[model samples]
Target: MESAIPAHLTVERTRPARKSTSFRPPYPSFSARFDPSVRQVVMAYFGVQHRSATPPPVVSEALAHLASVGGGVNRERAQYVDEAGYHTTVEIRYWTDPAEFSSWLADNDFWTAWPAVPDAGFFLEVVRPTVPRFETLFSNDRLEGVAVAADGLSGEIQEHGYWGGARDRIPLAQNDLLAPIGDVSARTVGDLVTVVPNGNLCLIRSGQEWTETAGDERQMYLTEVEPVLRAGMDFLRDDGLSVGCYANRYLRVLAADGGVTDKSFGLSWWRGLEDLETWSESHPTHVAIFRAALKYLSTMGPAARLRLYHEVTVVEPDQTRFEYVGCHPRTGLLRALG
Candidate 1:
């Protein structure tokens, strides 16, 4: 069989050019205070998958419950047939009081009901981070992510350097990186993994937009493009690639009315810049997918209603924090510790 990857798409990888360090922070004092009341955020991923074509009914009901009733749940992004070949949905929820979230988790009925569904597997990761430990950036003014869940933060990080010059701007305790925050945990339906954030982290927030008449273009992505992308992710996760990638998630943006939208965002967690670049440039799977995606976009032409964009931010270890509650044995930051 001929390979799906085109020959033109295969290109040699090269190192990026070094840049001069002439740029400096334009502001002398740039620091934001956190509101005392804003304690933590519960970032949860609820995923389900089955070998059969259709998922169990309980899976749908569980997702609907998360969308409809969960308090402190503010923003949700859903996706289907992810790299793991599972239907996954993530929600960035805020907690004025951590006890409320704990109360909901203590309820065992939902947990018992899900696993009993035949041939189904469900996983959940609830990450709680202190308000002051992480930084965020948004391309649009609309409040989202940490912004929706927390208060007392600066708007848009405008510092220079890969770490966002975060060390200078934000204060850190001596043992923040090595020490675990008591509140964070990760869990599957069966087991809960206790984990902590250990080192530097990077989050890439990227999005795509499509024109109104681009309904067909959207379908093309769902039918043709997304599978290849998901496959590449599976390759990364299962086969392994460059050393530093910790986790990657692709989420479909949901409209205010709880319907899926043309837009989607990807949250990729990395150990450092070099590993991320190595995978992006030299990984055979990524290169092929990149080429195919480009070809598809170009074939659509200027009249096409599709547009894509993304932004990357490197977060310092102290500037970011992660705690996993009831996560599986190896998930997220726990993968490294395990």
Candidate 2:
């Protein structure tokens, strides 16, 4: 059976890039916006410690509970998950104001419940970066406890399961997928990932589904899984892929506690268009994933196909979220501080 790219470090944490820091390639004729086009954007990165005996499902259920209560984060997307070695990553995204968001963080009841979570005793980073675009293209930076190629493509993304939701936090199953690869600081973090900052141009495509009960097995041609497959084959292969990301039913909890289907977004590292392009074509494993994506699509019948739902963002803030965030890398993940 396939496991996460072999763990380079015995621990889950890693150090910042030691090789060399270069701007991720830049988007051609592109621009950068401080904030997404939506009301606001906030993300949290979590690294769940991987244990030889512990099951990943245990971690998944713990996150599922946090996302349901208004405890973890309050936003559009409910939750997320990514894999590296024995670690798992979680992120949340949504529409809200800073003050209200801060209030949610301050609530003591939330963190109290965090410890009981699977791998809860691990490390995490609470950060808010300058969202260069609406559809976030992510890249991982080497830091703290990790030792891997400074360049992206350290290994293949385990591409574990994902969960997310929007509008109402409804537990929508089968619409989530995670596409994670090794540390992606290679080539460029500045260029290809942030090509468009157009709020009007970006759109949130959701509700693409194929239900088993639908009974039309022959109707498998029309499905959301197509874009997901395309994302790996065409998008990741051809587009500026600085950092790879995964999907989740809900990365955050909501006030209403209602959600549906999983969602996706970017991380702090991905940038630079040129570096992204170079890795896509040169990376051996990436090429392999693309070639195999077609076969993977075959496993998911029309009902198991992907859904079409995404959010288009527009920059409304003159200043960026970095103003409020203090991030320092301890493990492979960034640790957020005041």
Candidate 3:
């Protein structure tokens, strides 16, 4: 099928030159789900490296298959390469029952097939929010991001200052409830429970316009901004900071025709709001990157083909829940509260 995406913006998928080991399931159990009304959601990141500016057939096929299955996923969106050179796609699935999602994952062919394909990479993070545990703010009336992905997640559309003002609205608790379910506290290869700081889970979704036309602005984003953002994620994942930060992912929005757009998203799991603030404000790496990005966007203005914005949702322990099935031992919230 011909893609509606213009030739300049079209990104063909590419496979790795060589093969690698298959993704082995890390978690002891794969079947876990909260009540359907609670809006259990999963963000699955699937991608492949770009070779010669075109994506491999497998990459596109895998994405289509994922979207086709539905798997209780009410909505789906995708993007090609954002700043990250990898041709990545993300699917936000809402399952009425957690088990249904688990069953789909267990039987999905892409789970086994994609990894076998040379140079393909995939990871899934499932988030289930309890009532009154989470909050969302949007700038536009359009239903986008996680709000569009699930029911009962919509919020009032507000302009820029809303994020700053949101802090006061978020309810505070004197104690943190995110502790390991069992007694173990050290990083053991197969240990189920691990100790992590008390805090809430925060999800930030923000980005801007994506034009089919490409130029210097697109080039700069891919070359400059992408790397810096990637480095910050890497630091959080590998360093094992004083506060809890389970995982972080960057995704591009994919159109209906399987073409990628300019809009990008950052999905991260944090120990709490304070830790997230520390990284955003005090962390040298993050601070420098923010400064650079500001300058870049300011210079490009309307020509940049990108508009960046963000909304944050922080869920307290009782208000948030997570489940894993067929996942690695330390994946999602399970890593901290095994």
Candidate 4:
């Protein structure tokens, strides 16, 4: 099929008409519905890296400090080996309001407590987006990631199962270009480095869970769908700079014992919302992934047990933060600055 997007990018203040108005999901899917009173939400990723087989003392101490200061609506954990060959453990946390997050930080003096140059690697990445700037989609009734903090799941949303659906779900995209402005730059002082992010930076956390699958459904997802997904992720991680992707990390959700589980996600950063949308609609890598997923869902019909979901956001410059302590140059948003 030819791409629905134009070769040249254009900006409009009003929401553009969707090209796939007839599009509908083959199976039921839902989007997160936040409370009307809520104005903004925060998503923070706290990461620690080590060369050892297990987490070091600093990691335990950091976790304890985080527990004592508790303020997030929900939290989840994941692990991955970065390109630099270090074992990275990450804690993803969410908050429904920016004031609540600010109060938590101020009450705890969170900035002063941690060592500026920790013995182990550490980084903090934070994004605070208004309710309208972010969107979510889920393949199952069960909540995951940021959706865990939502008021409820929408009743079978119509904007999904096709390219550009993610853009359609975001309310701000209705009246803004969501175009990126400026560039990411870094400044270092001693062993600490702070990254200044661009305006309208985009972030996505797309996940998969197959724990409930059995029989033919299990084989199909593992053999057909997952391989294609991983390949697309790998391309974004390695060669995607030419396409506006800044960085990518394919992470494995970890169990209590730090063992790998049936869930995993590809966390990525993009230059802007338009860049991400263009790649998803026209890139061959994503095309293969979309086709493979559609085939799996079609073959299994309603009984398909595999679950997929994603949350995408375009954050303003003032609403973003990135800091690193004794970490490699390529860690997290540092790659963008690099």
Number of the top candidate by TM-score? 4
**Ranking 3 against 4 by lDDT, winner:** 4
Better of 2 and 3 by lDDT: 3
Instruction: Provide the global lDDT of candidate 2 against the true structure.
Output: 0.29
The 10-residue segment with the lowest total lDDT in model 1? 1-10
Looking at candidate 1, what is the lDDT of residue 293?
68
Q: Could you estimate the TM-score for every candidate?
A: 0.56, 0.35, 0.53, 0.90
> Model 2: runs farther than 4 Å from truth?
1-39, 50-68, 71-93, 108-120, 126-132, 136-274, 287-305, 308-331, 334-338
The residue-level lDDT of candidate 2 at 214 comes to: 35
Residues 1-338, candidate 4, lDDT per residue (tens digit)? Answer: 21111112223437764745566555677887776777789998888887666667777788667655667998788988877777788888899888988887677545323564333688888899987788888888888888888877877766666677788777777687789999998878876788878999999999999999988888898899999999999898877677889888899998867688999999999999888988888899999998898899889888888888999999988898888887876777777875
Better of 1 and 2 by TM-score: 1
Misplaced by over 4 Å in model 3 are: 1-74, 77-90, 94-143, 149-166, 169-199, 206-209, 212-214, 240-243, 255-260, 301-304, 317-321
The lDDT, on a scale of 0 to 1, for candidate 1 is 0.49
Model 4: lDDT to the true structure = 0.80
- What is the Cα-based lDDT of residue 330 in candidate 3? 38
TM-score of 4: 0.90
| Candidate 2 lDDT over residue span 1-338, tens digit each | 11122232112223222112232222111111122233334444333444333446645665566566563332333233333223333434332344554676666223223333333333333333222223211122211010110122223122122211110111111121112222222111321111122111111221222222233332432343344433443333222223321111112222234443333322222222223323434555445443443344455433333322222222222222211011112222121110
Error in Å for residue 76 of model 3: 2.4
